[model samples]
Target: MPYRHAWLFIVTLICATIFAFWRTYFSILPEAAIGFHIHGLTASLWLLLLLAQSWTPHHGRIGMHRALGRVTFVAVPLFAAGSMAVIHSMAGGTVGGDPFYALWGARLGFIDTLALGALLYAAGMALRHRRNVRLHAGYMLSTALPLISPVFGRVFNRTIPGLIIHGPQDFPVFGLGAQCGNVLAAMIALWLWRRDPRFGRPWAVALGVIAAQIVGFETLAHSAGWNALFLTVGTQPLPVLMAFGALAGVVAVWLGWRLPEARGRPKQDA
Candidate 1:
């Protein structure tokens, strides 16, 4: 079942991410070092990596899947760095938007960084127990769940005529979209979990992470305190945040590789 359907999820992620940013990233006159290129390139690369990861294992290329997993150890950090760079560029006025908008964007940036870190770390840990393939796949696929918020936001703003988004007050639109994406991911996880008993714990973890992110982003994206926090952290460079996120990814990979293998009968879908 996984080999049959894994490509569908990968394709969905690629389409969603690329279509959401096609105009901004593929402009006729692209600016040099404006950070979008970095962000877009890294993001696109990761999606491609995801596609490769999904494809290799399904096609009986376990060796290639392991090699690609190693690539993600590096790719994850670069992706976090790109997220920071883009947000920092925006917060620094390099993109030249309203100051308030920049601050809000910065806050969103921080959220994205944290979400990416959590997803990678959780997925890495899941990978550790090769005895539990269902959990491993659940975490791996669920990593993309948190990223759909921005995708939906961009797609909505561009496609919906005259969608006036006023600062953080109107953040509910994007917030709800993100939550919907999480719900969809949860539904998929639930289906997989029902198919295999081993999927329970991993699905629960993914759902917990998604629900936490939804609560956090929705609650704080509009709060005065959140605004103040970003304003205070303004222009200080969030390289530390990026570094922390990267460190989480590295630790996840290390734990995955170093943990003792589980010895048990392999569980399979009924």
Candidate 2:
């Protein structure tokens, strides 16, 4: 029952995603690669699942909520696969010397890897704390945080005046779009944590994840070693990379769900 109005926020994010990817994905759906289609469909489904999950419990449909929660066991692995597919595609582009990829793709790929890590952490925590309603809800909701940057960064690139000025190399001098998005996500997490500062481990963890992403983006993403690693990953078959991602998701879910509950935690409505 926490975050009773969370569906509204999820809806807004869905809208933002559509607006941000209209030109690149939605509008040119036919021209987009298979990886894009997989990622787009799975991502949209995850958001919709979140929306339903939020609304059902708030509307006194606890049974429905529990039923729908079972779907995540299947959905999450597919989501992971889609995410890796896109990352693999980006790496290939970078290796192929596409102008945009040559400059920014590696960095974005690295950030995305961090984002995936954050998502898996949140998902695992949510499952592990399922008996504590507040903790479970907090971690479930935190899943949205990792997705904010990819959507809003594009929005900033399109809408914010002078937000991304290209340099002589023809890429933005700085990752202003990503920075703005990360700042916004951090503020939201901080605000949520402040609201329940005494027992806000979920939000604190979320904040830590975001901070790691920010630091990684500013430093490691630009490093020669990271780029080399990414290029090596790119050389692997796309299906192999996607399978690895799917396995990671499955392992996270299994381990989290199978773990013993910690002592002294208060039980809450599921």
Candidate 3:
């Protein structure tokens, strides 16, 4: 597969995040409408990093990957900064329609920050254990985190409208669809981890951690107490987003770990 093929999952994730953003925060501008250039630039650069992470046929391509990795690393902090800047800018200047809009924007900023932190952690692991294939891939997947929220967001956006029309929700289905889908994805991933004999013990633990987080976030969102606490604490939304990203990353890492190495045996752990 082309590198982009693997990255398509990332593309889907971005869409999900956008849909959730539009639904919770503000609506998306028309595809053709010119909007904030800074937002687009920041989002696009983050995506460029995503695309760059895919290794093609070669294991080491210093000429191609190195040059890109340097800038990508530098932009790590910038991506978070620019994303938050655009969001706060949107909340103050562009978002006057719904109170929920502002809240979601605040939420997204926090989520992005957490995602960035996870990415940094994963990248650090890769650097520290440069030669361990499974561990390196695990870290890569973790770093490439935050890509799953968009997938869940898109799923909610695509399905909720129709669900509301058909179901007896009196009102629109609201945030339930997104939350349900998020939990379901986590559950299914856990199921896969449990059933697959190849995943080994480490993956079971990883997947278990992921499921616990899904439960935690869902619990927090539903609990009036947690909602109030998070509201008071003003933690950015990136952690919830990062939670989902890390869940998906754990799945990816599990599979990568289970796959046969080039030598057709298990690869060394980090």
Candidate 4:
């Protein structure tokens, strides 16, 4: 039981997600885009899955934990598809030169890409090291990091006064809200790594990824080349992009499961 209170963390994240998207998605669910519906449903299920996975093993229900773990084979692909659908939708928004999209949409799209990459990386590592309890749990728990920013960033934007100051063209001058959320995520990862440095490689990796994400948000998001690349990606068919994302998930799961366990690590029950 590496993360003894993991269920608590997952539950809190679920609550934060609901609060963050209440006005935009939950309150107007029927009117939301198909992509949003897909993303929301899959993402919520993923969190609930994480909750069950955490609770079962900690409660000495290893059988149930293994059963639930199989769900990720299907869940990961669907989650990835949903994520790509939302990314496509966001990219499409940058088409008509809306000031918000022109300035912020590309940045958001870039960040989304990084977040998705981080998710896949964490998931893959978790599956690959499934036999080593410490590594497996650490990697599995790290999956939650990619999700923190999107949830809390919205919360900050809406709750904190002047967090997202507007400038000319109604563009956001300071994206303090999202930055704060990312900083919080990084802090959590760093704290986790500090708790058990000997068995904290996964968290360490997560911390590096988050740091890269923050740096990319500030630098790569503003790059002319990245903006152009995102705009090009936006022009492609949504279905194609989603299909590619789903394929990546499938490949990650297959490869991770098939890979040999690390040397010198004894197999441990979930």
Query: Roughly what TM-score does model 4 have, to 2 decimal places?
Result: 0.93
Q: Which candidate should be chosen as best, given TM-score against the real structure?
A: 2
lDDT at position 251, candidate 3: 46
| RMSD of each candidate relative to the true structure | 4.0, 2.0, 8.6, 2.2
lDDT of 1: 0.63
lDDT per residue, candidate 2, 1-270, as tens digits?
688898999999999999988877899988877778888888888888899999999898999999988887877887888889888878888888877778788888987888788778778888888888988888888889888888888788777777643443525643788878888898899999999875588889888888887888889999999999988877888889889989998987887798876878787854
TM-score, candidate number 3 = 0.55
The C-alpha stretches of model 3 lying farther than 4 A from their native spots are: 1-5, 11-40, 57-62, 86-97, 102-116, 160-172, 184-213, 221-270
lDDT by residue for model 3 (145-259), tens: 3445434644654566553423223223434553455455555445544554352332344444445444554454345564344344333453443344445444433444345
What ranges in model 4 sit over 4 Å off? 164-174
Q: Rank the models by lDDT, top first.
A: 2, 4, 1, 3
> For residues 1-270, what per-residue lDDT tens digits would candidate 1 score against the true structure?
253577677798778767776755665426534556666777777778878887887788989987987787787767766666666555555235554445356447546756676666666765675546665666676676666666765666556544434455554455444455556655765665666554566656666665665676667665777565555544565666557656766777777767865656464442
Say what the RMSD of model 1 is.
4.0
Q: lDDT scores for all predictions? A: 0.63, 0.83, 0.46, 0.82
